[model samples]
Target: MYAYGIDLGTTYSCMARADQDGNIEIIKNIEGKNITPSVVEFISPTEIVVGETAKGDAILAPDNVVLYIKRSMGKQDENREHHGQTFTPEQISAFILKKLISDAEQMTGEKVSDVVITVPAYFGFDERQATENAGKIAGLNVLGIVNEPTAAAIAYGAQQKSKEDKVVLVYDLGGGTFDVTVAEIVGDKVTVVSTEGNHTLGGKDWDAELMSYFVAQFCEKTGVTADEIYEDGDVLNELILKTEDAKKELTSKNSSSFTLSMGRGKRAKLEVTVEKFDEITRHHLMSTLELTKIALKQAATKTSSKGKSCDQFDEIIFVGGSTRMRQVKEAMKKEFGVDPQVFEPDEAVARGAALLAHFLSTDQPQQTTGLGEGQSAADERFSEVTSKSYGVEAQIGNSMMLSHVILKNDAIPCSNTETYGTLAHNQRRVNIVVYESNIMEENTELSFGKRIADGQLDLPAGLPARSPIDVTFSLDRNGMLNITAVERFNGSKCNIIVKTEGLSESEVMTLQAQTSVIKVSDGA
Candidate 1:
C-alpha cells in the first residue's frame, strides 16, 4: 500500500499521493504551507525530527542541521566529521529520510515501507548510490531514485496527453542547489534526456546575502553590529527566519518590512526593496541560465528530430521555490524570448516522484527484480531488468555532481569505461568505483561486484602525477554493474575488481531487523 510521494528538497520537503484511478494530489505539513522546511533535527542520535519544528532549531546546531545534503552523494570516507560521528553526506541524508518517513507515518497514520526519492538531473553515480543508501539506512524499500527535473516533468507532463512528444526544460532551483534538466516526456514515461547544474548554489545563498544586507543596515541605522547582537543562537535563528520571510514577501510586493527578534527584548525593524535584492543576486540567477544552456546542448543528442538544438524546447517549466522571484522570471523571459511557465514549483517535484513511484511499482516492476540477493513474489515480474548505475561526485575545484550514466532513461544492462591517471611520476595503481549518474563531485568508487576492496590502489612510487588509467562499468539487463579499474606499477598493472550480489530474503530481513513499517493507506 503506497501512501504518498515525498520530495526531500534542499530547503523544503513535501509529500503527495495518487488515487487508484491515477489522479495525484499533494499533502500539506502541519505548517499550513504546501511545502515543509527541509531541515531535519535530532532529539537524539537514534531519533530525529523533520519539517517545520526542526527548522526552528537550525541555529542551535547548524552542523547537525542537514539541509541540501541531497544535491550529490559521494563516499563516506570522503565525508566530513561532525561532532563525534563521521558522517558522509549520504548518512546525513539518511537521517533526513528517516525523519520524512517517520513524520509521514505520524501524519497519515499509515505504514510506509517503500518510497520513490527524487534527485537532481545532473546527479552522478556516487550521489545516486548515496541517496539509495540513505533510503536503506532509513529502512525504506526505495521504489526508485529519480531526477528532480524529471520528476517535475512527470507531474507537468501528466497534463500533456498528446501523442506528440514534447521537450521541456525544467529549471529547478531549490533552497541550496540548482538543477536544469531537459526531458522528452511522452505518456507515462518522462525521459530525462540530459541534465546539468551546481549543487553548491541555491535560494539559501541568495537569502544569506539578504541577511548580510539586513545586518549592515542595522549597523548603520542603530549603530549595532552583528558581532554585538548576533552571537546569540536564538537571535541568529530568528534573523534567518525573518530574512527568509522578507525574501518571500518581495515576491508579491515592491518592498517588505520585518522586525527581527534577537533576544533580551531587542528588535530591529527592517524594510527592503526587491530591486536591492535583485542587484545582489543577479549573478546567481544567471548561473541558472548557463546551466540551462548546457542542459539544452546535452539534450540535443536525444532531440535530433524536428530541427533540434534549443529550438526543441516547446516549454520551459519552472519548479522549486527560487523560481518565484520576479527578477528570476524576468531574466528567464528576457533571455529565452519566451515566458517561462511556472507550475507549483514547491509541490510538483514530490508529486512527480509519487507518480514515478506508482509507475515503477507497477509499470516496470520487471526492471527492479533481483536488485538485491533475491526477488520478492511481488517483484518477480521485473526480474528481467538488471543493475543500477552508481553516481559519485568529487570536488575537483568547483563542487559538481557528475554522472557516468543515469537511471530509467539510459540503456539498461550496458557497460562503459572512463579513464583516469596517476598523479606521481612512478606511481602505478589508483582507486576507482563504478558509480551511476552524470555528476562528478564525490568519490563513491565501488559496486557490489565491483569495489576495489574498499581501499585505494597501491601504486609503485616515482611516476609522473596524473597517469593514464581505465575505469570500466559493465551492466546487465537487471541493471547491475561490474566496475573494474586497472592500475600501473611501472609499465602496466592489474585490474581492480568490485564484487557483490543481491540481498537475499534473509539479507533483506537482516538489514531490516529493527522494526517493520508499511504504507497501507491511500497516501497523502
Candidate 2:
C-alpha cells in the first residue's frame, strides 16, 4: 500500500518514501548505504549483481560490467550480447531497478508496487518512454516520471517555511548528465519557467579528463606506451577505478596521489593538486555555465513583460552528487553574485519524488505535517514546459523541411495540428516522420534536428497531389507524445503513439519474462 520514489541516476540510484507521519526517509540497500552504485555485473547466464559489489568487480572483469548505461537509454542499436542472449539498455536498467526494489521491500517490510521515478528535465520523448518501460519490466506500477531538477525544487520548496514567492535556478550536474532549470515557486506550487541541458555531459567527463592525465603521466614515467595500456582492458579499468578515487580525494584536500603498478614490477606514482584538476577541466565547467546562461535568458523572457535582464533570479540551488565538487561551487559563486545553496545534493530528487508519490497514492486530500493548513500535499500543483521542439517532415515547394508542431518551452498538456499536402500525384501513402530539436527556430532544414519516429499513413487509392492531411501532435502532462494523422477528404485517420526507441512491445514482454526468472542479487 506504500508508494515510493526512485532516483534512477546515471552513476548511482536511490529510493525513498514518505512515512505515515509524512516524514521522508531514504531507503538503504542491503549494504546499509543510502545510495547504490549504478553498476551491474553478469556473473553467470542467469545471475547478475548490482551496486557496490558489482562496481568493485568492474576492475577484475571489465567486459562483464555495464557502466554508464543511462547514456544509451534511447539508442536502438546499443545493446550487450552475453552467452547467446542479447540485452538492450532497458533490460540492463531493469536489473538495477529490480535490485533496488528487492532491497527496499526487505528493509521496509512493505510491498513496493506503485512508484514515481525521476529523469532529466531535458530528456526527449524516446528516453522518457524507455525509462517507463524499464520500470514496467521491473514489475512495478509506475505512477509517474518526474523531472530531476523539478523534483529537487519540490523537495526544497516543501522544507521552506516562508510563503513568499521566489524564482529559483537549479543547476544539476550528475554522473552522466547536466540540467539547468529556472522555476517559480508560489506557496506549494512549483512552476518550471525554462530548462536547458546536455544529456551527454556530466561528472564522468571530469573523470575521463583525470584518467587521461594519469595515463599520460604513467606512460611518460614507466615507459609504457598508451596503446599498450589501452589495449589491456583489465589494466585500463584498474586505472579508471583509481582515477575516480583520486578525483574524490582532490575534492576534500589540496592534493592527492596514487600509484599504478606497471607490469614487470614497475610502479608509476602520480600526484594531482586541486588547482591542477580545475585547470584541466575548465572547459567542461564552462559548458555548464553557458547552458545556465541560456536557461536564465529564457526564464527572464517568460517571467517579465518589460524585457528584464537575466539577473532577476531570486536564488540559486545546486542538485546532483556531482555538484559536490568544490570547483563547481567556486565557479557558481564567481559567475553569479549570489552564493549558491546546496539542497540535499544526493537525496533531494528521490525525496521530492517520494512526496509526489505519496500525494498520488492517497485517494483523499491529506495534509503534511510541515506545511501549514489549507496546503494539502495532494493539492500542490506542478507546471512543466517542453524541453524540445517537435515537428514533422514536410515537402514545402521544392525542398523538404521540418514543420514545427510544438515549440520548446511551451507549457505541458499542449497540442498543435498542422495541415500539409501529398508530394506526388495519386500518392498511395504519406510518410510521417517526427523530429525533435533543441534549436529554437521553426521550419528549418531536416538536418538541423534528428528524426525520432516515423510511420506510413495509407491514403485512399487515386488520391491527387496537394490533398490535405492533418497531422496533430499532442503532449501529455509528463511530456509523452501522441500523434494522429487525418485525411480531410475521407476522414480516415491513423493514430500512432510515437514508439519508444529502446524496444518493441513483444521485445519488452520477452525481456520481462526473462528478467522475472533471473536472480538479481546485491553486490554485498
Candidate 3:
C-alpha cells in the first residue's frame, strides 16, 4: 500500500514515495540526483533513452533527441515524426515518464502503483488529460492531478510557520508554459484563488531571446551575418543551447562566457547583464502582470462578497523556477503592490503533491497550511466546501438568472446557482449558451473559445426561464465543467459534455504496450 507523487515538468521530472510513516522523500536518479531532466532520445527507432543518457546523445544525435516534450503536450498540433513513426507529443512524454517510473521503483525497492502528478494551473482539459494518459502508459494509477501552483503553495506555506491566511501568487514560467496562480493559505489547507497563463510562453522563449543576442555578439566579433551563420540549422541550435546556459548563469553572475567552434568565425564573449536581460524579457514579464490584474479583480470581488478584505493578503508568495529572475519579482511587486515571496520554486509543487499522496493513501492527513483535518470554521477565508464559485453572480437576462462558474480565492470547488425567469409567456423551446465573462469595474466582457481571456461553449437548453430556472455550474476537482439546468415548471433537464483534450485513442493504446509497467498484487 505505497503511494508515489511525480512532478512531470517541462524541463525536469522528479519522483517521491510515501512510506508507512507518512513521510515523503524524493527518489534520486542513478546520478544521485533528485531532479532528472525531462529529455528523451531515440536510439534505433524502437529503443529510447532518457535523462543523462539522452543528454549525452544531444550533440551527436541532435535530430533524434527530444527535450522539453512536456511543453508541447497541450499544443494543438503535437504530431511529431521521427524515423518514419508518427509520435504524438503525449507518446514522447510518456517515454520520459516511463523512464522516471522505472528508475524510482529501483530506488524505492518496492512496487509502485498509485501516483499523484502535477500540472500547470493554466493547462486546459486536453493537456491535463494527455499527461494522465502518459502516466497510464507508464503503468501507474494516477490518484489525482494537482495544479503545480497550488501544490507549490502548500509546500511553501508549510515551510512558513504562519497562521495567517494570505494570498500568494505563483509565477510559474517553465520550459514551455507560463502560469500565474494566486492561492490563499490558511492553516494546512491551501486553495487556489485565481489562475491565468499562456501555454506558449516559457523559458524556451528566453532561450530564443538570448540566441538573438548571441547572434549579435558573434557577428560583432566575426563579421559574419545572420544569413551566413543561421543558414545552417545545426549552428542555430548550437547557439541557442549555449545562450540558454549563459542566461541561467547570469542569474548570479553579471556575465558568462561561451565558445563557438564554427569553421566560419572566432569565439566571442557575450557580456550579459541583469539590466540587459530584463530589457529583453520585459514584455513577457509585463504580460504576466496583465493576467495578475484579471486574477486579482476576480479574487477581489470574491473576497469582497465573502466579506474578506483584499488587504489581508499582504505577502505575495511565489513558487516556480522561473521566478528566479529579478525582473519577474519586480513585475509581481509592481502589479500586485506587494513584495513577491518566492520559496521552493523547483521542488515545492512536487513536495506538496507528495504530502497529498500520503493523505490519499492513508487517513493521517495533517493540515500543513494551518488547516487541520476537518472542515473550516466561519472566516472570510472560504470555509469548508459547502457551495463554491469563481465568477460573480449576475443576471443573464432581465428576468433570468445565471451563475458564471469560476473559483473564488478562498473557496475550493463550489457552485453558485443562478435563477432565471421566463422571457415570455408559454415559451417552450429555449437556447442556453454558456458564456464566461470577465468583469472590470462596470464592464462585463464575453469570453468565447480562445478569443476571450477564458471562454467556453454552448450548454444545453432547458425550458425558457419560465418560473425561476436554476442553472448550476459545477467545477470538479479536475478543473472541468459540468452544467445542470432545471426548468422552474417540471424540472426539465439538458446535459452536455465539453470535448476534453488529451491523447487520441490510437496513440494511447499504442503506448500502453511499449513501456515497462509494474503491476501490484491486488490481494495485498
Candidate 4:
C-alpha cells in the first residue's frame, strides 16, 4: 500500500508522496501542474469537471459551478444542485479528491490508497470527519488527518539546524480561511501548543472588498446601480475574476486597475492603490494579528502553567497564498518585533504532510540533509491541543446556560471530569447536548454553542434531588469526541459518540456507490 499526503486546501489542493529513501516528491496533476484549484463544475448529471477547467467555466455557468466548497464542509443543510441533480459538499469534494488521485496514479505509475489529508487546525470533530468521508467517497483509505499548521511546522523544522528546542508560530492565511498556531519543536516532534482562527475569514474577503469598490466606482461613472450589475451573472463572474487578479497584482505593485464594460456603450476603468487596499481591509488584517496574539498568549499561559517562561516565540513562519500580502508580514513584524520568514507559501503544508507520510511509512529516523539527531530530525512523538471549548447546555434556574467540560487549548487525547447534580428529585433521565463553541467565551448568547451531538442518559429510578453525576468528555488524538456520563451511586453510565453532523455510514456508502459511476475528466 502506498501512502501519500494531501493538503486539501480551501482555494487549492496538492498531493505528494515520499520515496523509500525518505525523499519527498510532488505529483503534478493530469494537467501537469503542481497545484489544482479547488473548484468543481457539473456539466451533466454524470459528468463533473475539476481544477482549472472548472474554474474557467465558472464565469459562463455560474449556477452550475461550485467554488470554495471546502467552506461548506460539515454543513448539513448546504447542498449544490445543478441540472436537477443535487450534491452534498462532501460529494463535490470527493470529485476533487478523485481527480487528484487519478493524476497521482499517472505520476507514480502505481495505485495510491492510504493517505494523510491536512485540514485547518481549528476544524472540529464533525468537520474533520467530513474530510475523512470525502476520502472514503473517493475510494481512498485515510490513514490520518493532520492539521495544516502542524504540517508546515514539520516541513520548516526539517530544514533547520538548531539543536536547542524552540517555540515557533505559524500564521496560515489561505484563500478561504485563516489560522494561527504556536508550536514547540524538539527534535523531530512538533507539539502544537495553541491555535486560533476564523474559517470564514481569508483572501476572499479582500477580493470581495475590492470587487465592491470597483463596482461602486463603475456605478458612479456609468450611471448604473450596483445591484443591476451584480444581478447579471456573467458580468458579476467576470468582475470577480478581474477583482481577484487585481488583488494579486496589488500584492507586488503599488496600484492596479481593471476595465469594466457597462451597458449602453459605456466603459469604466477602476483602479485601487495598495494603501487604499490596506486601509479598506485593515480590520480583517488586524483580526489575523489579534488571533496571532491570542494564540501566543495561550501558548504562553500553557508554558507558564508548567513554571516556564515561554511567552516569546523564537520564530514566525508564514504559510498559504494570502500570506503573500505585504500587510500580513508588516503586521507580524510590528507585533513580534521580528521579520517573519516566508518559505514556500504554496508547498509548505503539502511538503510537511509528505514528510510525515515518509515517517509513518518507514521506521528510519527523520533527518535533515546534513544535520543529525536532535538538530536535524524532529521527534516523531508530538501532541496537539484543542482549538475550541466543548460543553453542554444546562438549565440553570430559569434559563439555559453553557456548561463547558473541555476548555480550549487543552492537550488532545485528554479526558476531564466535571460533576453536576440532578435538577429535581426523582429525575430519571437527563439530556446531554454536546456543543462546540465558536469561541471559548461562555454565555447564553446565540453566537456560541453549535450543537454537534446529543444523547439521553437514563439514571436510576427515584433518584433524590441533587444526585451526583459525573460527566466526562474525552477528545482523542484525531479530535474524535466521546462523552460519558455516570451516576456515581450505581456506577451506571451512558456514553455517546460525539461524531454526528457529518456523513453517516449508510450515507457514505451510498455516496461512494454514486461517485463510482460519475466520470471525471482526465485533465483539467
C-alpha TM-scores of all predictions:
0.72, 0.93, 0.79, 0.92
Error of 1 at 357 (Å): 1.4
Give the 10-residue window scoring lowest on summed lDDT in candidate 2: 302-311
Question: Which one is best on lDDT?
Answer: 2
lDDT tens digits by residue: candidate 4, 1-524: 55888999888999988766556788899788899999888888888888998888878999888999989888878888888877888899999999999889987799988888888988877788999899999998887778889888887877777745878889999999899998888776788888999888989998988888888899898899988998989889999889899989988999998788856786888899999999989999989988888887777766722346455788899999999999899888987798999978888898888877665555453443343454323235456788778888786667788888888888877899888888999898999888887566644543477888898889888899999889999987668889999989898788989764646789999999998998987433
Q: Cα lDDT of all candidates, in order? A: 0.63, 0.87, 0.64, 0.83
> Cα-based RMSD of the predictions, in order?
8.4, 3.2, 6.2, 3.7
Lowest summed lDDT window (length 10), candidate 4 = 370-379
2 or 4: which has the higher lDDT? Answer: 2
lDDT score at residue 376, model 4, on the 0-100 scale: 22
Tens-digit lDDT track of model 1 for 1-524: 77456787778778787765568867655445667666655444445566666676676765555555655465444554444544555555655666566556676677877687877655544555566666776678877766677678878877666746677778988888888877665545555566678777889889999988988877676666779756766667777888998999999999988876554565668888999999988888888888778766656655534556633788889999888989988988898877899988888988877776665565434344333344342232111111133533322434333335334335443566666655457655554443443323234333322221233556666667776665556654323345555554444444433332232335335434431231111122
Query: In candidate 1, how many Å is residue 200 off?
Result: 1.4
Count of clashes, each model? 79, 0, 20, 6
